[model samples]
Target: MSAIFNFQSLLIVILLLTCSCAYIQSLAPSLLDRNKIGLLGIFWKCAGIGE
Candidate 1:
């Protein structure tokens, strides 16, 4: 009984991780663009490149 319960818990954790990863993966493109803009903004400010 304990073993079965443990197995079910592990399965639930795995499923949750998989689903969350997929959701994040779908957002990867937008996230990357946002990060790129953020980095560029930082560089422009630090180096006065944009000004």
Candidate 2:
């Protein structure tokens, strides 16, 4: 009985981790692009592109 309980808890933890990872993975690209754009903006200003 204790073994079965442990297995169930382990399964639940794995499922939660997998879901969270997937959620982060989905958001990662947008987060990365935002960072990239921020860097690009700094470079653009340094280069005086709009001036």
Candidate 3:
């Protein structure tokens, strides 16, 4: 049960990170923008949207 909860929490974090990526992209492009692009794609394929 704990393991399953942990996995769910991790997915939530990923979704939040994806949201941040979108926010950052809209706010301003930066060095981290490159990595966020890849992370966004990965999260979309591996998880669901949170925002």
Candidate 1 ranges with C-alpha deviation above 4 Å: 1-5, 29-51
Residues 1-51, candidate 1, lDDT per residue (tens digit)?
A: 453479887777656655654455455535423443564444323222212
Q: How accurate locally, in lDDT, is each candidate?
A: 0.47, 0.47, 0.54
After the best TM-score superposition of candidate 1, give how far the Cα of residue 20 lies from its true spot, in angstroms. Answer: 0.4
lDDT of 3 by residue, 1-51 (tens): 553479887777766777865565556555344544564555433322323
lDDT leader: 3
TM agreement with the true structure for every prediction = 0.45, 0.45, 0.48
Off by over 4 Å in 2: 1-5, 30-51
User: Which segments of model 3 are wrong by more than 4 Å?
Assistant: 1-5, 31-51
Judging by lDDT, tell me the better candidate of 2 and 3: 3
| Candidate 1: Cα lDDT at 10 | 74
Top candidate on TM-score is 3
Candidate number with the higher lDDT (1 or 2): 2
